[model samples]
Target: MAADPGPTHPPQHPVLVVGGPTASGKSGLALALADRADGVVINADSMQVYADLRVITARPSPADEAAAPHALYGIVPASMRMSAARWRQRALAEIDAAHAAGRLPIVVGGTGLYLRSLMQGLSDIPDIPADVRQAAMDLQAAIGSPALHARLASIDPVTAARLHPTDSQRLIRAWEVMQATGRPISAWQADPPRDVPAHLSFTTLVVEPPRAVLYARCDRRFLAMLEQGAEQEVAALLGQKLDPALPAMKALGVPEIAALIEGRMDRATATATAQQLTRNYAKRQMTWFRNQMPAALRLDAMELASGTAFTKFYDRIMADMTKNITKMG
Candidate 1:
């Protein structure tokens, strides 16, 4: 018999992550996988980590969370800072443990960078000093976002071009780095970690619906949230006094949600604003994934409503992954 050609390089790591816009049924999908008790669910969403404002953030319900072997959600207090580096570290650790036990690590969330850091590595930046942090925050409070972006422009024009004037976190971080270390913020971002070739073989799926459909969905979903005690959740979140700059607070509908809660905007206004913001964000996500993940296994998924829909989705994904893994092996 003729000798069979063996595979050359081994495949990358094995991790299944489900990503989509808010209310896109990611959590339910993770939970369904866990129903078999053959998998562990870890959060990749940035907002779900904050413990204080769980309900408003649309975090996994306690029942769903209990139904699965969940990790990395509702652990961090809103007062503390959690970065992509930190989340990646935690996810890798959980992924390694789950794989060792022969369980699938069903990672799901909406945050793009958290997934990026897991697949690509993150820059190993040391923590900023408290004084430096306070100084930057104070400057932000004193001057304004425009002033902060101007300073970033002066320090690192390349970075400034990519950042918006109102991007509070990026603007403040750039200014903080420039002032504290006397170097451009962009300098520190030069050596972010690249591949996780040795850790696991994996497949990535990006859920991209058409712009009009996603916008309509976003509108319906936000209105539904209001009917389902979203106001109550917002009231709870208000008690946290979390920094407005926290990534959670910047979720698509969050500002408008907050506005409605605080009486600055009515429900109608909040609904309209949320729909617009979400639509814009969905388009941005689609663009990023389309351009950056052309090689990814793109799955054309509509609104994933029930836990079952997610199960079928991943069954398809894992089957494809297994085929590739076997070929590579």
Candidate 2:
């Protein structure tokens, strides 16, 4: 048997990013690759960061974590709001640490914004003041998403055109930026990002499953989550009464499950509603990954779903790594 590389022989290009829609086997693929390559798995999904919703968010199980080193999963408290910037900073540190220890850094998740911030870099817009942010949030709450979107369009048409009318988060962000800095968010974005190191190299893989198969998996997964203590998880979170506007509170199954727990809806209705929402969210994720990561290698999720297909995929990656190491030598 070939000896495990351990911490001795680092690859020339040391990062791999696996991204896909929810329930598309991204975590499985990342773990398989990590096992083969002696890599460290880092979280890139926004929802998986919260310490509260591990089961509901489908974060890697304890067995998977023991199989390889995993970072950033379930590290933050549910009460704290984790922004993309904070995640990016922590991820960069994890990537650097992995490389220093001669392990491949495997970043995997479904969150497009998080991945984009890591890969393409992010705008260096100054932080919005608390008052500005609060005002934007208050206005949105009072007038609703459509009205807030209309207001954003009046001040920043470019940013407004890119966002959906119901996209409360981005709408509030744009409004806050405009209110804080007296410049549109789009204008600030046109300026170059402040800190992207030129030395980093990334190998990206995007898994897009067939829609019918993916949707079915989404539905089945939610049912499985319920069986696997998701209701209790939400019940605990709700017991804390964290701000409803917090991102953790808005995870895919969270609101529906909360409604069910609060007696506002029955189990059957809540399950169906959560399943539908998961499918819709998955559709949006699929579209975002397709459009934003154009240069990434695209594979069907089914290609990595089975042991045989995954073995083939793993072998290909290893072969490529060997060739690259040879070329470097």
By lDDT, the best candidate is 2
Which stretches in model 1 have alpha-carbon errors above 4 Å? 1-13, 29-37, 192-197, 247-252, 303-316, 323-329
Which pairs clash inside model 2?
A: none
Model 1 C-alpha lDDT per residue in residues 109-160, reported as the tens digit of each score: 7777787778776655566798998889888878888888887797799889
> Using Cα atoms with residue i matched to residue i, what is each candidate's TM-score against the true structure?
0.82, 0.89
Worst 10 residues of 2 by lDDT: 5-14
lDDT of 2 by residue, 210-315 (tens): 8999999999999999999999999999999887767898898998999999999999999999999899889888888888888777887566668888788877
Q: What is the lDDT of residue 205 in candidate 1?
A: 67
**Top TM-score prediction, candidate number:** 2
**Residue 183 accuracy (lDDT) in model 2:** 96
Q: lDDT of each prediction vs. the true structure?
A: 0.73, 0.87
